[model samples]
Target chain A: MARKTTQTRKAVVTIAAWLIGIVIFFPILWTILMSFKSEGDAIKAPLAMLSSPWTLESYGEVQARSNYALHFWNSVVLSLGSTLLALLIAIPAAWAMAFVPGKRTKDLLMWMLSTKMMPAVGVLVPMYLMFRDLGLLDSRIGLVGVLTLINLPIVIWMLYTYFKEIPGEILEASRMDGASLRSEILYVLTPMAVPGIASTMLLNIILAWNEAFWTLQLTTSKAAPLTQFIASYSSPEGLFYAKLSAASTMAIAPILILGWFSQKQLVRGLTFGAVK
Target chain B: MATEHSRTAARLMVSPAVILLFLWMIVPLGMTIYFSFLRYNLLNPGMETFAGFDNYYYFLTNAAFWDALINTVTLVVGVLVITVFGGIALALLLDQPFWGQGIVRVLVIAPFFVMPTVSALVWKNMFMNPVNGVFAHIAKSLGLQPFDFLSQAPLASIILIVAWSWLPFATLILLTALQSLDREQQEAAEMDGASVLARFWYLTVPHLTRSITVVVLIQTIFLLSVFAEILVTTNGGPGTASTNIPYLVYAQSLLNFDVGGGSAGGIVAVILANIVAFFLMRMIGKNLDA
Candidate 1:
């Protein structure tokens, strides 16, 4: 009888959790749903809105109205480009700090993290002026450089955390086996930290992809990513409800899919030290 | 043995990124400091002189500074409270064995992956619009009045969107922490005839305290810099209702083009952000070391 009651209680909690989770997720789901509806049907009452016959008209219209492919490409280049650059730079820095102990290692890491805390807007003027003066504005290379720098600390921190989990004895063994420093890290440490690195890559991509401030302010036309694509739907005249939702849905779809596939790694990377 | 040559190589490998960031930090900061002491504006080009703390004095005594300070604090605190509490509740619920658990977890985390601008736009248009939004439809169906979420309570609405976006982050962290708790302790507590509330308060909450702190610290860092949401939704209006320090600085520089005043405001923002960062860095540093 007690076991049965416990089972029932568990069932109730599970049901409630599912209900709340679905409710929380409804907005995103609803936007995707609305993206399939015609403009008139999108603003219809909720009851009819959900049950309305879906169409691809909004997607077609959104494509016709905006350069979806360009935005998609810019997002791809900026996010992947910045993430790759950051990892290349961060791996070495993290390797030094993680494997090679020095007095200022912790202080260096702290300083990098502190740099992240400085509000980006605080330096917007200088960055904008610098970019303009240097003719780097609205360029993919410029955004890549800035994005990589901003996310460098996070990338290093994550890689450093993953590197710490590795036993020093393993590296000691590799070194004793005549592995050079380059091969030691490239062959041994890199392979071992794949999961951590993969998750960090995924997380950094999401961050850079979703990054709105620099991307919005720095780029006007040439290199504006999907964040700009979504923002374009907003105007002083009025909000474009249906088209905006469509843009938002399009902007987030790829990352949402990516996040779903990498949930395990993300969860683990996030909980790296919380349990300990 | 790790040789001196290897250490030098390591430093060389990291030098490009380090030097870039160093310049990135110094150049802007030096400029802001310089501009803070000078009389400069975009409109009054080439007519400049060192004003010696005049900009600082003006900014400090201004009411906009205090308003932005309050809004920034309130937004951060409000979002933290909601996410932390809401996250704990959801995390506990998710910890229970459930059918389609993976699917539910994905759904819970989906909002976090949405771009802030997109999420804000989603909330602004489809969810919170007074006439045609889903919330209005529901209110009307239930025989209630429609509400203008953005206009009536702009700051609160923005806070809700932010809290919603961050809920999954907190929940995932807390859930991971919760799962790490020893099952034996919970069983023992239950076998001792402790009520559910006592078991939760004593066992689960204690286990989650560290995760809570981590979540609070990380989220505080991100939340303190919240800009995209406010920019997308209300543009920091209904008369500065949703304006945070970042928006305030943006307005001062980009809109007003009062370079000296704006740079001084920028320094003020830096000081404000560091106050939180100092403590957060300490905790994060401790966590990293451990």
Candidate 2:
């Protein structure tokens, strides 16, 4: 009787959980569905909207209408560019702080994390004015610099946590083997650190990809990423539901996949390893 | 582990990042403070004079400032309440053994990956549009009036959208903490005849309190600066109804060209965020030793 009741309860719980999950996911699913329908059919009653014949017209129209490929390429460049730059600067710093037990390392790490808290709006005016003065406004290189700075702190923190887990004995062993410091890091450390570094890169890419505030404020038509590309749909002429859905779907699909892969690192990264 | 040679090399390796971050933090922030003191306007650049805090006076005394402040707090508090509580419920449900748990977790977490612009636009046009939205269709089919969600309840609608995006984050974090919970203790309590609710109240809530605090502080920091959602949806709209500090500052500086006034507003935002950051740093700092 007890086992039967437990089985029944599990079934009930599964149904309830699945129902709630679908409800939560319904908007994204709906957008994907709407992207397949024609513009006129997209805004129909929910059931009617879903039953309409699917089409690839909107996807083709999105690309034709707005040079979707350019924006997609821009997103790829900005996110990948920024993450790579941040990784270059952060790896050494995170390595030093993780391995070198200095008196101020804790304070230094905290200070770096504190920099992430300084709201982007707090510096918007000067950044805009400076970017304008430098002719950096709406330039991909300029936005990459800004994205790199903002995300650098997070990359360092995540790497620091990951690097902290690497045993010190290995480095000591390499040193005793008459390996130079350069070779020690190149051989002994790089292999062990690759997974952590990869995870950090993944999480940072998702962050920079979806980053809206600076990306929206900094870029215009020439350098706009998908975030800015999607925002263009807010205008009246861009209100076709099907096209908007198509653009949004394309904009988010890559990051959504990347995000799923980085779920474990996200908790560690965002929480500064506090939870994990 | 520390040799003098390595210490030097470590310092060298770290200097580039430190120097860049230092400049990044100081230069723009200094200019904002300097600009706030002058009667500057982008429309008439290089024709500025000292304002003697008049900009701050006007920005603070203005009716819009108070409204933005209130809206900012409400948005943060409202979203925190929903995501935290809703996250707790979802985490508890997912913590149970069930069929297709992985798929359900993925489905629930999908919204967080959708960019803010995409999520806000989708919710605004598809789900909340009164005339042709899913909600309107449902309402009409049920013999009720279709509700204009954005115009009638702009801030609340925004709160709902923001909460949906963040709920996954809170759930994922809390679920992680929940999984770490000692199963032996839970079963021991069960054997002791403790009610399910009692066991949860005593064991689970206590274990989750640290993560809950982390979630609240971190989310509060991000929520205070919500911009794109407001920008894309209502544009802080129906007359500043949804304007928070960031949007208000953006409008003041970028839209209105009142650089001095906007800088003042920006300084105020910095101070406000600093207060929250102070507490959050302490929390994360406490965890550092462990």
Candidate 3:
């Protein structure tokens, strides 16, 4: 009797969990499904829409009408560009903080994290004016610069936590073996740090990709990423649901896959190592 | 580890990041404070003059500011409440042995990866629209009136959308924390004949408190400045009904070209965020010691 009850309970829980999961995920799933339908079919009621013959007309329309490739390339460049730049600046700093103990190292790390707290809106006016004055407005270089600064603290923090996990003894052992400082760092630490650096890069790219505020405010035509591209559809055009879905599905698909891979790092990075 | 040579190199390596961050934080912030004191307008340039605290005075006294303030708090608190509570329930459910758990977890977390613009547009167009929306279709099928969500309840609708995006985040963190919970203690409690609710209240809740606090504080920092969703969806209203502080400042300066007034609003937003940041920083700092 007891065994039967436990199996039945598990079955019930499984069904309930799957039901809730499907409901929660329905929006994204529906969007993906709708992306394949014709404009006329997409506007129909849910079941009818699903039953309609799937087509790639919307995807082709989105690209042909909007130059979707340009925006897609822009997103790729901005996210990758910013993440790489931030990594270049953050690696040595994170390395130093992780290995080198100082009287105020903790305070310094905390202070850097606090800078991340400074709301972006608080600096919007000055940034806009400065960007305007410097002729950097709506430029990829300018967007990259802003994205780097906004995300630098997170990059450094994530790198710091990851680098901290690397054993210091390896470096010490390398030094004791008469390896030069350069070789010790290049050979001994670099290999171990690569995984952490890669994960940090992944998380930062995801952040920069989805960064909406600065991208929207700064970019108009030239440097607009996918976020801006999708926002253009906000004003209702007649029966463009399929096209919008196609664009959105394209925009989110890459990052969703990337995000799933980086889920563990995300918790630690976002929390600033608080929860993990 | 603290050798003098290494210490010097560390400082050298660290200074570039520190100097850049200092300039990044200070320069724009300084300009904002300066601009707040002047009657600056982009449209009518060269007529700028110091206006004392008149800008601040007007911004504070404005009816729109209060509405934005209230909406900001409502959006933040509303999303936090939904995400945290819903996250806990989802986490607890997922923690149990279930079929295809990994795939289910991925599905639940998919929303967090959707860019804010995409999510907002998807929710607005595909799900929440009065006509041709899934909700409208369902309502019609049930012989009920199709409710226009964004206009009828602009702020609340935005909150729901924002919460949907963030629910995955809260659930992910809470699940991570929950998985770390000592199974031995749970088993021991079960052996002691503690009811499921009793064990949850005593053991599970206490373990989750820190993660929950982290979720709340971090979410508050992000939620306090929700912009993209509002921008894409309601544009801050049917009539300023959904505007939050960030959107308010954006409108003040960017839209109206009222730099002085907008800077004042920006400063108020900074002050508000700082209050939350103070608590958040203290919490994380405590964790650093631990």
Candidate 4:
């Protein structure tokens, strides 16, 4: 009797869960569907819109109208460049803090995390003036630099948590076997840290890719990322739902795939490993 | 692990990150403080005279400042309330025994990854636009008027859109927290014939308290600085109806060219965020010790 009741309950739960899930995901699914429709049909009643004939005109027009390739390249450069630069700076710092105990390590980690909380507007005036004077405005290098700085603490924190979980004895064992300092890290620690590093990389890429605040404020035409490019459609251009959907679909698709895979790391990273 | 040579090496390795972060924090912050007291404007760039407290006085006294403050708080609290409650409900359902759970979970969590510009723009144009949006079509089919969401209830509309983007985040974190619960305890309670509501209220809710607090704290940090949504949707329109401190600061400094006033507003925003940051740091700090 208990087994039969549980089976019924499970069936009921499945339908309810799927229903809610589709409802929550409907906007995105709608956008994708509308991307394939003409402007007139795209904005029609929901059932009519879904049943309309599909076309590739909007996608083609989006590419022809805007420099979509340039923005795509800018996004790739900023997210990847910043994540790689952050990794280079963060690994050693995380290594030292993880293996070498210091009295101020915890406090230092907390202080760095606090910097992430500092409202960017608090310094927007100076940063803007600084960017203007340095001729860094709307330049990929400037965007990369700022993104790297903003995300550095998070990269370090994620690495430190991962490294801390590793036993120090292994590192010490490699050192005692006459391994040079460079080789110890290159061979011993690097292999063990790969998973953590990959997860950190994945999470940060999504973050950097979707980071709207700084990217929106800092860049204009020359170095505008996909975020800014999509935002440009918020004007009258966005009224053409088909083209808007096509552009948005392109901007968010790659990161959405990456974001799905990084769900586990995201929990660990964003919460500062508090929940985990 | 205690050799002086290695300790020196460690310091050398860590110094680059430390030095860079320090410079990043101090330089701009120092300049913002310095600028707050001067009569500065971008357009009238010249030798600036000092104006102690006037920028603060004007910014503090302005009607728009108060409205922005209220709107900012409303935006934060409104989104928090919706997401936290909705997240708990969704998390509970997702935790249940079900078929096709993986696909449903993926579908539910998809929005968090959509870039803000895309989500805000899509919601504004595709879902909420009165003339041709889906909602209008729905209303018209029912023989009702097409309602203009952004203009009529700009702040509330933003709150809904922002909440949609954030619900996945809250659900994922809370679900992760839920999965860590000891099933043996739950089964034992079930054997004791505890009612479902009683079980949830007494056992599950208590267990989720820490995770919920973490969600609230983290979400508060991001919500306070919501910019792109407003920039895209309303541009803080209908006469400062949706303008938050971030938007106001951008307007003053960039649009109005009043650097000193903008700096003052920026400092106030920092102070407001720091108050929340203090509590959040304490919470995480305790977790680290545990």
Winner on lDDT (2 vs 4): 2
Residue B284 of model 2 has an lDDT of 94
How much lDDT does each candidate structure score? 0.85, 0.94, 0.94, 0.93
Per-residue CA lDDT of candidate 1, range B71-183, in tens?
99999999999999999989988998877788899999999899988888888888898999889998999999999999999999999999999999988888888888999
lDDT of each residue in B1-290, candidate 3, tens digit only: 47898899999999999999999999999999999999999999999999999999999999999999999999999999999999999999999887889889999999999999999999999999999899999999999999999999999999999999999999999999999999999999999999999999999999999999999999999999899999999999888899999999999999999999999999999999999999999998998741
Instruction: Write candidate 4's Cα lDDT for A1-276 as tens digits.
Output: 999999999999999999999999999998998899997888788899888899989999888988798999999999999999999999999988888868888898899899999998999999999999999989999999999999999999999999998888987898789999899888998899999999999999999999998898889889999999999988784468899999889888998899889888999999998977
Global CA lDDT computed for model 4: 0.93
Better of 1 and 4 by DockQ: 4
- Span of 10 residues, lowest total lDDT, candidate 1 chain B: B281-290
What order do candidates take by lDDT, descending?
A: 2, 3, 4, 1
lDDT of 4 by residue, B1-290 (tens): 56898889889889999999999999999999999999999988996889999999999999999999999999999999999999999999999999998899999999999999999998998889998888998899999999999999999999999999999999999999999888999999999999999889988999999999999999999999999999999999989999999999999998998999999999999999999999999999888741
After superposition on all C-alphas, the RMSD of every candidate to the true structure, in Å, is 2.0, 1.0, 1.1, 1.2
Under CAPRI classification, how is model 4 graded? high
Each prediction's total of clashing residue pairs, residues at least 3 apart in sequence or on different chains, is 0, 0, 0, 0
Q: List the residue pairs that clash in candidate 1.
A: none
**Candidate 2 residue B121 C-alpha distance from true site, Å:** 0.3
Provide candidate 4's TM-score on chain A. 0.96
Fnat for model 3 comes to 0.83
